[model samples]
Target: MPHSLSWGARSIFKNRYEFKVRICYLVGEGRDLNFWTDPWHPDGPVDSQTSIGTMLSNIPRNVSVHDIRSDSDWKEVLNSGPYGELTQIVHSGLFTKELPSYPLVPWYSSLWFPGHLPRHCPVVWQAIQSRLSTKDRLFFLGSQRDSTCSLCRSEPETHHHLFLACSYSSWVWRFILLRFGYRRKPNNGLQKEEEWLRKTFKGKGQIARAIRIAFSATVSHLWKERNRRVFEEKSTHKQQTLKDILDIIKFKTLYLKLQDIPSEKNIRISNILGLPCFSKEKSSRHCTWDPPPEDMAKLNSDASLANDQGSIGGLIRGSTSNIMVMFSWNKAPETISELELEAILEGVKLARSMDIRKLWIETDSMNALQIITGKCNCPWRKKVTLKLLQDLLTSFEMWKVSHQWREANQPADYLSKHDCPLKGIKILPTTA
Candidate 1:
């Protein structure tokens, strides 16, 4: 129906375009997803119900994915024998927790660099990318009255002007720099200041780290003050802002002192690894074991080599500080470190099933700790061990695997010298 009555004639495609992508229907009103037809199970489709060796029928062809509600409803839809067990197998898949399903920002690595504050990094990262919701950005996105700078009102509010050229921000920077015994006025614009500060902190020693911290803190707080004025209709004095800048730098600097930054201006291009320790000590330290918290369990593990055979041993202790379980796994001849990792893997698997909510795993092998913690990268090491440990840590509510000196882990050491052990977690009651 052409209301304008202006078109004489037109020709279009005779057929519609076709696509073959499967739509993953999110489970909703329970009316759309077909129970048998849709491939909703994590493993595979449950068509015919015979896939899992179940002999069954009479399920409505249009039954929903979430058809089971109560025990009676489940019994009604799923037969008590073969079909019941099949449904039970796939039910867990229907409600499995999904991982994050969002696009990640590219500035992620830049946000978590050494000396960056966890709380302020995202905000600063946004500002660095000029993606912050500054007045100009808001106005461009259809915010009418927010187009102008509130403090100066001289120019359209932009990231550069708000953070760099604004007289109020400049004054705050000058005041803070003077307090730091810096009589000079820093670069006046955001890009210039950012570049200069990056170059300035490219030198060696404590002064460079201190200067970088102050610069980042100042930028973060000045933006905070600007945001407060814009949204909350309030303004803190320049001196107060200066004090805040110093306090934040001091607090965040306590936990972030990793000098991973490269000074060659080819910064962060490559991950520089520290040289591994090759020196062997003649005498070991005499250290005693320490127990974990009462509600937690501690797992100590060791791997030893004897007569061209690798033996892995570990022990788990309950909150009462008594041994809960001990295990030894016979492995083919491998490096001592690899065997140590296998022992730890066994210990972690044991702890998860022990009814304890928290676990503190200890290993005398520093190489194992370093690899697990991501402090050192070793391609020659076992990647499966690393992946398993990472997954276990995330699944458990609380767990920590750290390096313990050989002196502190005597039980695991003694067990590693044993002859043979089946590959499993030993289930035993409290014993002497």
Candidate 2:
């Protein structure tokens, strides 16, 4: 009840109804129970129904439950009290089944997804819970001179009006929506907008993270701007506020490394924010095919996946770039990285079978390459494959693995895309 309580403590206090339902007192001699304040009854706290005059005269406020019983049965003790309604209730049972429990809120995951901004979380959480001290709430509590939004100076400063209905906030939201490539306009109210965001950005991918960052940043900045206008008598242009939001997003996303081969949307956003989509230090633009040393044979492999079905393809070429073997195999749906690792495994197996002493491997997937080279963690499901592949590479006198741009791995890319045979096709392997 103290005004100086922290937000975390305040949140716990606010959910007292949910917490209160799970607690029920079983009176064992009632030595420790307060007669009035304690919820020893099956119903609830006894003091809730008692009048102030009745409480003052009947018993001391600090009286314990055991003091009234005094070694007597509960029925006799209850029969002497007012109206004796506690007799049947005590006889039946003291179960929490009668207490009303609160259901879990659905928006919790959206509010606290992975990689969320810590400082921005509280503001967004307050907004979602309608706990922010907006001007309307202040006015209702008799502490505000005006309830109009400071940014727009037109609409009442309620959560719905400030977040969605206000002209300034709406423009900021629309601009962010466009930046995220959302064609639909924001919803009519704060709750609807929150529900829309939860339903739309429901994943742990880059785009989802970006969307959440934008939402949290916008809410925090908007509240900040509102406070500035009210307390500091200063204002920032809505465009500048939006730019600040983008800057926060850009800063936060720097820690989020992209997937080995990012999606088109992730690439677009990364480019917009100037994030490095590839894990490699070098850019893929300058990557080109290079023939290995005269003593080494190079294996280039690639995988293509569509609708969870995929194929792996590769070609082992001699030091002179002469193809020694070309292979493509259709496969059941699996992760793209697994398929890429499979392609490398098949290519290496082919080279080993041909008695190549020194070998070089190239693939377009940085993830698979990293896993094979021990540069990153291998997914648990693909550990066996990677372990076998690593063991097989030990057969070669000398071997190296490297990432190549899809542009340079054209032969393997073409075979992966077009040369995949059907499930029952008994196709023969091609060799030079």
Candidate 3:
């Protein structure tokens, strides 16, 4: 009755398909329906076990038939039912069809697919539709009289003319070709350039990636250059635009290479950020003092002032003694706190040059000492100065920074006043 209605019906249909089948039964006024007859024999009907020989004949080879009354009970039939093997076969076929052909993906697609493609593909499709529907011959051409190419006045404004066909574009293309050692002439049509790109990158791995990155960056830059000239009333430079493309290519290539090596992440990030390559030059513009020595006996000094242009003072002393180098100056700040910072930097430079190891530095500028020790807020001008101080700390064997009263740093203070006029160097008299 009703084509052997029961949970077994689920084996013949699922979800919406099962719902539609149930609707068909209602539409047929609950009449007995035979699905396994000639018309529907391919799909077959639910099994009945009235005759053992008939049931055995109805079951397909290598299949087992079972009865399931509920969704949960279907598991038992699914695991060992007449259709279990068929289900497995269907699943395997579906999976095989869905598997991606990883190797066949294009070079540019591989490079930009992860992030850019998820966003760009839909956008490109939309643009293609809009461009096709527009009345203008050139996809982006405007109707205004002034909307003509600056170099080729005969053509409407378009991406192809501004980047490939126009005189300015030819000059830029030639510059890029010469710089990169390519001898080909600029393609006059955008389609030709696309074809050239496809041919040029044909089986080359590294070259293809470079070309794709260069092409995309060039497209973006050319559009920007065009807008700048039209809207901002600016002139575009062919060499500069070509240089931008080359720079982008070099940067992306290096970045992708770095991404492949997990251990070089930090180094690559530093390079991207324009950090100085690590070295042992022993002197940099940022350091305020030289590193200490292995002997545990050295002198260090730092000068600082409340007002950079007001007065600068510093003291240099041996790690274990009272006497060393000291100086102070009254030069006014060029900006805000430049004079005070320069004084401290000069003291550090002296220590570095003298090869001072294990030096004790004293400064009357509490704020400067706090910044050096990382115990206080740093003024904006002191950012570079603070970084240099940190770099210097890594170079020395031992170093100490201390705060002292301005009265206690009299000798260096006197030396600064005396040196201000003559701009002369003076050695501190030994108090011992």
Task: Sort the predicted structures by TM-score, highest score first.
Answer: 2, 1, 3
TM-score of each: 0.36, 0.47, 0.31
User: Model 2 scores what on Cα lDDT?
Assistant: 0.78
Candidate 3 colliding pairs, count: 10
Please report how far candidate 1 places residue 10 from its true position, in Å: 49
Roughly what TM-score does model 1 have, to 2 decimal places?
Answer: 0.36
**Which sections of candidate 1 miss by over 4 Å?**
1-110, 177-188, 203-205, 254-432
Model 2 per-residue lDDT tens digits across residues 1-432:
888999999999999866774685566666788877877666566677655326335577898777765434443545554635552334433322244568988877766777787898888888988899999889998999789899999778898888767889889989988887776666578778878988987767666777788888888898999999999999999999989988887788778854433567767867776665663343547667898999899999998898767888888877787777888888777889988988898888888888899999999899998888788999898888888898999988999998898889998887777644574122234655
Give lDDT tens digits, candidate 3, residues 376-429. 777776688777867776677777767655555555555544435424354564
Candidate with the greatest lDDT versus the true structure: 2
- On TM-score, the candidate that comes out on top is 2
Residues 146-240 of candidate 1 have per-residue lDDT tens digits of 58786676888888887857877777777655554456565456656766666655643333554565666777887788778877999888778
How accurate locally, in lDDT, is each candidate? 0.66, 0.78, 0.49
Candidate 1 positional error at 20, Å: 20
Model 2 misplaced regions, further than 4 Å: 1-119, 133-158, 171-187, 191-218, 221-298, 304-310, 318-324, 332-337, 348-407, 418-432
TM-score of 3: 0.31
Error of 2 at 360 (Å): 5.9
